[model samples]
Target chain A: MSEPILSIRHMVKRFGGLVAVNDVSLDINPGEVVALLGDNGAGKSTLIKCVSGVHLPDEGEIRFEGRPVSFPKPIDARSAGIETIYQDLALANNLDVPANIFLGREAKNRYLGGLVKTLNDKWMLGQAEQSLAALDIRFPSLTQPIESLSGGQRQAVAIARAIYWKARLMIMDEPTNNLGVPEQQKVLELIRRLRDQGVPVILITHTMPDVFAVADRIIVMHRGRKVTEKRTGETNASELVQYMVGALDDTRTSA
Target chain B: MTDSKAMAGFDEPALSAGKRAILLISRLWAWVFLALMIVFFVVAVGVFSSATFLSVRNSQNILVAIVPVLLLGLGQTFVIIAAGIDLSVGWVMSLASVLSAHAIRAAFNAGVPLFLSVVLGFVAGVGGAALVGLVNGLIIAKLKVPAFIVTLGTSFIVRGMSLLFSENTTVIGLPEGIRDYGNESLFYWVRGEGGGFYILDKPEVSGELLRSMDRILAWPVVITAVVVLVCLFLLKRTQFGRHTYAIGGNMQAALRTGIPVDRHIIKLYMLSASTAGVAGVLSTLRFTAGSAVIGDPLLLSSIAAVIIGGVSLFGGAGSIIGTVIGALIIAVLTTGLVMLNVPAFWQFIVVGAVVIIAVLIDQSRDLILGRRGRGT
Candidate 1:
């Protein structure tokens, strides 16, 4: 790891009297693949929302590249090279692949009234194709609407889009949950490829096999606390579950 | 515009999990706009000039004659796009016009620069509307009041502001340059018997039986052209335009994607109202009167044009082209009805019918298209 991409200290989030995320500290270095595993109502979504700038933390400090940062809007997060692929992916089904890839950012010619007044489809389509190809996606065509792609193909396209836009940190919330078995495998391969390409990824999932398969490090959340942080090779599934259920804290002696 | 990745299969779990944005240009509304154009032209020509009604000059005159309303229509596009409405836009126009005339008179007499005063008056009109729009946006976005209630209230407030200035009196003095914009043509003027001076403008077509309409060219037509072209650029080419559509389409999804939804809506309201103010200035310049009362009839007319232009009341699916065409239709219908000596009250009846019919057409098309397949 060349540098720490994300560093959080004493991060806390509250919804009225409800403590959704308690004082928790975590860090992810460049090119690292960290998995955040938790059961339902374990504050996974709330924590994700805080990180993705959907909700502000009540008390906390978030640092990107050692500089203090707070995002009031998701655009601030995205512009700073942090891209979150939401559970629903947030892809506009009505937009074509190239259009979707360039959503909110259509390339334009600087010179005004240049008779060829249109979106830079040539550049966008080329990039979309290259991204899908780099991620080994088997989508039908760049011209097809994203809705036409299978679930896994869509996930691949999403990962490809994030990586294409030069995201140093990709936050994927259950990229494989709705995907077919083969699609899950495709996403697994995409995750490993992202890490190998020096793009750090934050994989939030409850799937034990997924955690064991690609995560270099694991952070288990139980009732809004980071109960465990261990290397994938340093722990087994049962110990991770105990940490997730809040029965234990950071002790990987079982593995 | 920002949420490109919220894509899910129509039946996928992702679809059920979070709301998504639909980015299609809305084919149903486009078709409805086309139908309105056909109906408007047919009715106007049939009811008025049997032979010269659908001629090129007549159509062009119709297009040019309605340029002021078309400008006002541009403002309506923004307000409606932001899911807000401005009933005060008409009064804003009248106020802007009277102020411009009063400024011109003051500048012409005091040895001060009339150019600066004209600019100042222009700014006053836009600034006044913007002030009201900001309040409208603040009340709607911050206070959680419905857009209708806030704007409806502010409309009266703005109208009262204009009344305070006008005092039931039309401003008397207007500079030559301003009036030239409304009355003069570079190549020609439609001169009548005994050297009567008039441009080939609105009052002509509805008055005399024209052997040819091409001979009657008005400056408003030129104004309409420049306005439509600029509006198209703003709506389709710029970042602000994209933001406007995104806010209208699905605001929640836009927010998750990091769009500044509130600021965007506020800017839209300002843009909409300010454009109406500009229209008022032009109308004042054209009529050569600082009449504090302008566009009283235009409140309904401005909104009708936007709706009939194919913009959905739900927002996010319209073009400047559609709006211009819609404005032309309204002006032509009015002129044609007057040509038939139809009572002005009946004109209101006709306009009301046109509005209801347009909405119904839009709704029915939505039904027909809704039953059909979904494509990007």
Candidate 2:
């Protein structure tokens, strides 16, 4: 991989003396899908939070674009071209899909010599229509609020927000956990499409189908440590489970 | 985009922006109810008593009496919109009156320029009230305490301060200019049309009013109207206004959207107190005498008018015009009862019942509308 897009080195985190993530490290390369796989208490979410700047690692270094960086807040992380699409999808239900897309960063027009500013509704709606189309998200009306949309459609808007911002790295936590078969396939297709467009994604999930369907590399964690790392093409789902349970390591594999 | 469609509901483009300019004004219906009540009271007075039931002088007197209370209601709207209540309004009024009275008397007795003491009194009253408001905001925002408890505590504190300073006494003397600011006619370009007849009494602002209508509007009423309009514009049009609604609606949702939630809420609390100070100043100037007990009775009515105006007790919903109408409804009801010679004790009962009924209606509308949305 040509100079990792995002690199983590010995990342550690604790919550009231409970070592949630103890000295873990991973690298996400440009145009590559890295799967951070773990079971319930494997510290996958904690590591993702550290990378997304939601929590400051207790002891570790996070390098973005090959330079060591520290972000005090999530907005700082976003401004640095790192965006996280959370599982809950924090889109305002009362607002339309377009409105949800350009919510905080609203386009404004200065009508009276910059003394007065107004929401540029026409411009934002047009852009929302385009972004929704580019993502292949079909909604009945461009003006319908997100609450009126199906679960898949709502997820589409959240993904569209991540993509439209043009983030260099996107981290999705459990992107397909609640999705049915068709929706899961749709999301998988969307992930491959995102990779083809040159944005690296960190998919955090325990579903082997999701891992096999998209990941270029799989990193398994148990307790608070990274136990096994392998290229996805060379690995099998059953063997990955052994590493997750600490019955196997990266060095040894048993049938 | 057409006028009827725009008025019927909020269409895409607002056509009423220029010609009619009415958005969020469904609140004005209550004000119409207030006007009707006034007319009914006038009729009742004419039929039952020998005293002239209605005349230009009595009509204007009723308006003047209601003006200060309306100011208080307008100020309270800001606080309520921020999901807060200001129970300190009555105390704030008393403080303003005492401070202004003392300042006027001291400066007048101490042989200083008359205007200087009046200004000093205003500054003292408004400034003290604002300081307490700031404290209220700081406490509520920083400690994350509920607003109702904090304001309630502060109300007793300020009330105690007012009593201690006044010693339950009344300050009698006040400057002419300060008093006239609230009471004076200022101008009456025409007296009246020499009447050809005097029959059944009704507000005859036709030629009779037209003959005397050339005068500039009273400054107090003008001031109150200006404050209401500015507040309406700010709450309905500005970014801060939108933030206020968002915070009141759901603080967590607002914060996630990157709105500076705590600061905005605190500023809202302070704004409420500051406007209460303005009303207090107006009240002090109107009454002339600085009674230690000034505006004690206004608390319940001021709040009643605000809630009745269609301002949601649940917060996140309400309008300025609604508050004005609510205030007017309360005002007209009180005045109408007195004009019809209803006994003082029955007047409170009547007003209290009206307040309760209005609040119940407002509460039910909110309950229905809230369940309609997807739990915003």
Candidate 3:
């Protein structure tokens, strides 16, 4: 089998005395959609944070493409092609569409790049329009501030930004959060598109229907430890619920 | 089936006509108010004949009079836009004026060229204010101190330093060149043949035009215009400007985006202080003296102008152009009242009432917009 795109080995993350992620390991390969399912404080968020470099594991190691790596900051993870779409979407409400899409990494004028470099609005605007159009995302106006956009449009912008950056692995925390039924469907479709385009996605969500709709595999974490991993087609939602509640301890099982 | 439906089409929801109108009014309300006020003064002066408020001379006077306030307000706009305030700007200006005046005087006595002395004085003034701003920024940005308390405390400390340095006396006798630059009109009006004024660059006009009509242009006003232009560019056209809005809108989001929030804030405070320093130099040049209390009244005026300019005290919105107009409104009100023989005390009451009214309007606009769409 080809090497997993991201590999974690016996990772442990603790906040003071409380172990938030205790000796958990996972591997994610290309073109795979992995859904992280658990109740609140089930170590799902903690594990995702550790992978995306928002939190460093207290023990164990993380390897990307078979090489051990450490990310001290979120930027470090981003530079390594791991984009985490945090809850709230982490967007500046005052900025326009193109500005938000190209916030930290703005396109600069090439000729004036060395001297008096300014934002290349023309290029950014064109690219932003094109990206949204390709994703079938329609917004009111690119010049309008993101603050005025509906919740679904805002989520679309965040997803488009991650995809535009060509993230090899995307970590989304509750992508369907606060979304209505239609918006939730749009997000699920976005995730499937990411997977079909050969990008691996790790989605942390509570909705069972969302997991069944798109995710190819489901990993359930209970009390800071991974209890089971199952193929979406092979296992039912009830069986997955048992693992989430710590009712089942099918440890060391490969999907 | 759901995937196909979700992926197939996205219908763009258009903004309703009423919501669009509300947004338009909210954005342009400040400018409209300014224009109406100007019209009111023009009509009042034209009918009452109390003073020549409609003439170019009165306009020049208003421009020059509000230069310092405008400058300070320009700087305060940045601080406020970044969700911070700099209460010490007025005192910082005073300190800069005293320090620069001393430097210029000392250099002139030591046989340095008048121009060099003036430059040295200006640099010293800016440096002093920059130091004060740095302390403010460091405490507010790095140590996480509230900008209000930090700047308020620094204002007192800076005022004390100004007093201590000048030994409780107003520093006088600035270099002749500096004074001339401040007082001299770039363009002046002379008496014309038809009993009106003819604008002339030189005072060498013969016959009836020789006597001064009124200054058409003043150096202080020119400096203020340049400052306004530069600030407009900084706020509207630069990456720093974008970051300022970002930080002000949501600091946590700015941090997650990897913006050096503290550094941007520090730079903002420093810029605010530097503008205050420039205002100080202009003040000294205009008055030919630097007093410890020269900036006392300016504190209230600058804050009032910024708030009145539509720059939300809550931050993340506003423009330098709005601030310029806001400063002009206050200046015009003060001058217009004086021309009408209204007592200075009553002018204060009027301005206070106007500020409260402006804030109420701003708050209501936000509320109305919130009901229409996502409330920023």
Q: Which candidate is the best by DockQ?
A: 3
Deviating ranges (above 4 Å) for candidate 1? A1-19, A22-33, A49-80, A88-133, A136-161, A176-193, A206-219, A227-255, B1-51, B111-146, B173-180, B186-215, B252-263, B332-376
Docking class of 1: incorrect
What lDDT tens digits, residue by residue, belong to model 1 across residues B1-376? 1221222112243322112222233334544545575576567657666644565555656666686788888878867765567776777777677676666677766766666766666676667667767777778777878788877888787777777787574776666666666655533333344233344443344344333223444565665577677778878776566556655654554565556677877777777777777777667667776666686667788888888777767765567877776786678777666655678888778777877877776666455334222211
Choose 2 or 3, whichever is better by lDDT.
Answer: 3
Off by over 4 Å in 3: A110-115, A252-255, B2-10, B194-201, B204-212, B369-376
Best by TM-score: 3
**Model 2 Cα lDDT, one tens digit per residue, A75-187:** 78888889888876666554566656765666677867988776666787888878766656556566744544555566778778777877899898888887777667767
Which model scores highest in lDDT?
Answer: 3
Any residue pairs clashing in model 1, and if so which? A75-B258, A89-B5, A90-B5, A90-B6, A91-B4, A91-B5, A91-B6, A91-B7, B64-B221
Q: Report the lDDT tens digits of candidate 2 across residue range B129-167.
A: 777788888888889888889888988988887777765
Fnat of candidate 1, please? 0.04
For candidate 1, write residues A1-255 as lDDT tens digits: 465889989889988888889888989998889999999988878887787778888998999988898888787888888999976676554346765666667676655666545556678888887876666554546675455466676677667778778887899998889677756766787787788888889999999989987899999888887777899999999988888887787633544
Candidate models: Cα lDDT each? 0.70, 0.72, 0.84
TM-score of chain B of 1: 0.76
State candidate 3's DockQ. 0.50
What DockQ, on C-alphas, does every prediction get?
A: 0.18, 0.16, 0.50
